[model samples]
Target: MASDLNIARHGPQDGPPILLIHGAWHGAWCWDGLAPLLAAAGFRVLAPDLRGHGESPGRKHLRWTGIRQHVRDISALITGLDQPPIVIAHSMGGFIAQHLMARGVPMRGVAMLAALPHTGALPIALKTLWHHPRTFARILTRLSLYPMVADPADAARLFLDPATPAPEANRFHAKLQDESFRAFLDMVALALPGKPARPYPALVLAGADDALFPPKAEQRLARRLATTAQVLPGAPHDLMLSPHTETTARHILDWAATLPPGAKPPATAQTAPQT
Candidate 1:
């Protein structure tokens, strides 16, 4: 199944590779707007629907799948590439990227957008439970992640900026699928990733108006990575989506220009074991 990931490839074959990782409940479709922009900027972009989301097949196993499995899937993809690709990871995907770094996976660089904090997502979970008791109850009863964004209003509030049109928000909500419940547990307590043993060029960008993880959480993540956070004003949790995608892409393009030219994959890099 490792070879069966639904990956959307774009741009020139010989261009520098840029791997785009979507967050929880989202899939490669979430990168629709941002991928084209990155490809146009001369990047060979690859966006994969992590198992159980989007076109990728794993629905039956989603309930048991965790973050470590997702990381292994990505590690395989990187191993197959001609050169180590720069990774652009968002939200939960950021955690996966951090895990790769911790395990000594080679990469040209990493840009984390609206990433979960190293301290874990317990605070976000508690805040959601306090603010949306009914929804939280549904999540608890069903043992599912969908309840949190089942309503279009809730989805818009959590992931989109207020400036986004209602129709667009509804469409985005419709596309959301159930995330791995086990992965949620891993993020909360079971397997919070630590700082990487080896350093690489890193950037953290967050939405100023994100309802989930706040700017301060992203700032903390940046500090751990030995970098500074850049908060995009009016942006929300889904940075690759509407209103601020171009702005997000511009920041990434600017950062990509600064990476060392012709960097080679490290000998220490190793492919993760297949699940």
Candidate 2:
């Protein structure tokens, strides 16, 4: 059975709605710093924990769940909203967002932060591990075997900027939950070619210092999605929790303002992509 997603809503009720989707090993809590900033900027933000992550149930079946299950969860949330929201998705969440778009989910716009490619995270992971063998070996070993929880140092190396405060990094690391191995594989297996081209505007943003998805990959992904890529200097993969959180939120808000007014869809039924 699927678990109910726990959603955290912020900002005024009358503001334009924005849906924030976190990546693997992260939950709605990942948007803690970014959501309020976007909210204060006059957007209503809704961040939801994917099944088996954070406070959501179904952890015991995480290994059995894949991208299809997660897509179902998010599809339900979008359908329940009063309007098609501007989606700001990070890493694996970006992958989910793309699937949603391919399924023809209407939206005001989408902002992808260090998003994984349609081809998936495997190549990125291999490259990252090859570059920083010792550090990633420890992290990947535990991740492949345990699939839940991670070492703070490993998390810092993978997600944090070099100048990130140790305290903040530790706190963020502590909040991470176990990711689904099946979901990771599913992300790798999914491709974008056969899916219908999305008509909605998309902003592809990446961190210059992101080891996982480098600038080249980001640009390539933008090309694949028919959009230009934007890079943030000195930023890491986890931009939301980094010092650049406010800047990222502001950029998203600004981009959203530039979108066509009629892009926002009225409340409508949403159907999940056939798995």
Candidate 3:
């Protein structure tokens, strides 16, 4: 199952690998903009769709998939890498990464972008219920997570800057799909991955105007990582898709540069084999 994961690769294959993990309802497509930016900076990038998302298989079984399975799937990918790759995770992807860290998965470092806090996602769920009661109701009634972002306006308002043009927001919404109800419960504390097995370099970042997770949440996550959060002004939940993407990429690059040497590019660069 892990070998079958749909992975999008970029940059020089032998260059140090960096894995990009997207949040709930999102897939590797969310990193389409940022992956190239990182790749151009001399790092190989691998973005894999979690099971039931994007081009990954098992969409019909999404309802049964949970964060635990996601952790295993991703951990397998990391183990298969030529070397431990730096991990970049967003939103719920960040949550899954936490589980990996707690379980001692090998990685050079991690940068959590607008990730869920260790405290759990109950607050986020409550906020969603308050702001989008109809959508929330639909989610419960349908036993699926797609209702939360099924509407373009709702998706834009929840995940993008308010100033984003409607058409662009709609296009973004179009790419979103159903997420697992069990995964949402896992995030809300069916289990908490706790802190990392040991301290490793980490960076936490968030958007100031993000409607879902706030700067404070990022700060809490940073504290857990023994780091501080960087809150970008006017940014939204989807920093990779927002106008702040370049800035976000720059920050990640700068952080990666400061890390103790990890994976190194081969003398002759080549693209990695597709997963």
lDDT tens digits, residue span 174-208, model 1: 89888788998999988898668589899899999
Candidate 2 structure quality by residue, lDDT tens digits, 1-275: 22277789999988878999999888999899999889888888889888888877788888667887787788778767777788999998998888888787667788899998777777855765677676456555654523223568767877888888888888877887767767766766644323434577889999999967888889988887778888999999988875888879877878888987634354445464553
Mark the regions of model 1 whose C-alpha exceeds 4 Å error after superposition: 264-269, 272-275
Please give, for residues 100-137, the per-residue lDDT of candidate 3 as tens digits.
88877778999999998888889978988897788789
Instruction: Provide the global lDDT of candidate 3 against the true structure.
Output: 0.87
Descending-TM-score candidate ranking: 1, 3, 2
Please report, as a residue range, the 10-residue window in candidate 1 with the lowest summed lDDT: 266-275
Model 2 ranges with Cα > 4 A deviation: 1-3, 128-149, 190-196, 262-268, 272-275
Q: Give stretches of model 3 more than 4 Å off.
A: 263-275
Candidate order by lDDT, highest to lowest? 1, 3, 2
Best by TM-score: 1
State each model's CA lDDT, in order: 0.88, 0.78, 0.87
